[model samples]
Target: MPFTGKSGKFNAAIRTVEIGTGDKAVKLGGENVLPFYTFDAPIENAPKIGVLITDMGLENEVAGIKDYYAGATTFAEIAKKAEEMPGADFVVLRFEGADPNGENRSVEDCVAIAKEVGDAITAPLVIEGCKNVEKDAELFSKVAEALQGKNVLILSAREENYKAVAAAAGLAYGQKVGAESAVDINLAKQLNVLIGQLGVDQANVVMNVGSAAAGYGFEYVVSTMDRVKAAALAQGDVQLQMPIMTPVADEAWNVKEAMASEADMPEWGSQEERGIDMEVETAAAVLASGSNAVILKHPTSVATISKLIKALV
Candidate 1:
């Protein structure tokens, strides 16, 4: 008898979720096997890259990312830069100024900026909240109402604020919501269940299984995501089947390796190159772990990661 290798089989496939509408929409997830496992099963859609834009403008951005928007002054300009970038599939409008302890910008101000950017770019927008749970719930609610039916992805709904954000996303706006959890697979699954119970369709929910920088507990993130996907596929868990999203840029840029200057550590090499590599390497790791979309900063990393994905899938 001739020797033959056993064929691999998967019980469930990742759910496909659509963001935006009409000709500009993008599909995420929809894979029957693990990330880049094309030899085992066909991939329905390639992973996507979402460029991060902020309401605070480039002056408030980290030094490493400021050059990308030199002379740009408005949200419209930022959207234009993202659209022109080679691999940008969507835009993330982070309302950093909405933090109550920070600028404490009004909800009206944040909504105005979101509307401006949404109208400026045809690419789908992910309207991210300031990390303040209470403030984000109220702020996101108003924003969702204003942008109803535009097909935006609201980021996100946590244990403390899932009810308000989920209701805004599914009931008020008919949009999608990102359900976030700490780096625990069970917590992630529970949040997804809670979001669904709030009347948001499971298909409209995306899982943000938590993110960590390259040298800072990134392995934990990988393991959590792996387990989440495994439960969705091998264990036949529907609530855990939503696509995974990782906001890599925020975590990657905040780390010492990405933020430290050459003067601080000459042996570490150029800060610019190190920062770009940090973002690129972190994003690559997350994608390889079955993330369907990654929110990124810096055009250099975006282009590099895009090329890497092309060679991969």
Candidate 2:
């Protein structure tokens, strides 16, 4: 018998979630095999890269990020430039100011900024909240309503606030909802279950199953993603079949290794270089572990990862 290669494709595929509209819309998931395993079967949609910008407008941006934007100072200017980044498939507008503990920015103010960014850029939009459950519930709902037809993905609907966010974003506004859970397979599935029970279409849900910087006990993150992908394809797990999108910027750049200045930790090399390295490594790790999309803040990281994806897939 002639030697033959066995195909590893599975019967089930990750559900396709489309954000944005018209020609600029991007698709996530929709592949039957494992990540980057095109040899097994054709990956229906290539993984996506999203550049994250906060409403803070890059005030304290690192040297690299500052240089990238140059004279673009306003939120709208930053967003437009981000949309035009080398490999940015979409732009994430994080409303960090909405955190009641910090800036205590009001919902109205955040909404105004969201609308401004929404109107300014044609690229797909993703709304990242300030992580305050109560504030996010209100902020996300209002932003969802504000960006109604933009088909944005609210990041995200947690256990405590799922009802309000999911209902408003997925049901009322006709946008996508992100079901976020800690780095646990069971938690991820349960949130998806809860979201599904809300009458939201499964196709409209994406998973943000938590993330961590590489080398920061990241094994757990990798294992969690690995199991989710395995169960989705091999075990036909519908609840776990949603595409995974990990936010790598906040987690990677905040780690002490990335944040420590060269003066404080001269052995760590350049602080900016360290931050970018952590981000790129973590994003690449998650992608290989089955993430369909990864959010990054550095232009070099985005360009590098984009080239890697192109070469691999």
Candidate 3:
């Protein structure tokens, strides 16, 4: 007699989260099994990709992506370009200049730029701050108020500032919040719980598991995400069941493999192709590991990963 392999069943499924409204809306998560485990179960919704933009304007953008920003000086122009890109499902507006150590832009300036980009694009927006906990709370709150009813996903509410961010996004604006954790499943769950305690429904939360670039402990990040999904599905953990989002652009692009010029490292081959590959590969890793959506930087990576997701699904 021949023996066959045993198939396992998951007790829970990833919860679905919707962003935007009307014709521009998109749903993430809702998979009953692990990422791309089609043989075991059906995938209710395919992963989505959001292109990352910044308030830094075109001149400050990376050289590889400058062409996409051609003749687009303002936030509105950049948002338009991002919305028109072939594979961009949504746009992420990163307020990098708002860091108190950086440009230290005022809350008014950040809110103004957020409104401009939010108004220009019909696609859903993911508004992120510059990682300064105190400043980010204030900035996010003001931006959420400024763009009410846009259904934007506020990029982060950490353990340090979840209360203010969650209150502004979930309670005040009725928007979504990206609850972040530092590559730990327990912390990821805990942050979700804290956000929930603030009266934000679990459905309005998305996990950001602190992405690590390829070759720089990427496997650690991947495994952490995998474990988070396993706890959500196999263990029926409600706090971990929400969809996950990874901001891969900054991590992938900033690495030396992507930023080093061809002249600086001839053995690495073409600088352009290398950088694109770094982003595409990093995104693939995260998606396979358990990302329901990702925020990418380069247009080429967006198109490439879009193809990869279609093929996978």
Predictions in order: lDDT: 0.88, 0.95, 0.89
Ranking by TM-score: 2, 1, 3
Q: How well is each residue in 15-97 modelled by candidate 1, as lDDT tens digits?
A: 99999877878998998788888778778799999999888888756565687777777889888788778899999999999
Model 3 CA lDDT for position 251: 88
For candidate 2, write residues 1-313 as lDDT tens digits.
Answer: 9999999999999999999988999999999999999999988799999999997888777999999999997889999999999999999999888888889899999999999999989989999999999999999999999999999999999999999999999999999999999999999999999999999999999999999999998999999999999999999999999999999998999999889999999998999999999999999999999999999999999999999999889
Superposed on all Cα atoms, the candidates' RMSDs to the truth, in angstroms, are 1.4, 0.8, 1.5
Q: Is candidate 2 or candidate 3 better by TM-score?
A: 2
Q: List the residue pairs that clash in candidate 3.
A: none
Runs with alpha carbons beyond 4 Å of true place in candidate 1: 1-3, 60-64
- lDDT score, candidate 2, position 193: 97
Candidate 1 C-alpha error for residue 297, in Å? 1.0
Q: Distance from true position, residue 196, model 3, in Å?
A: 1.0
User: Which numbered prediction scores highest in lDDT against the true structure?
Assistant: 2
Tell me the TM-score of each prediction against the true structure.
0.96, 0.99, 0.96
Ranking by lDDT: 2, 3, 1
Whole-structure CA lDDT of model 3: 0.89
Question: Model 3 over residues 160-256: C-alpha lDDT tens digits?
Answer: 9999999999999888999989999989999999889889999998889899788898878988998998899989999899999999987887888
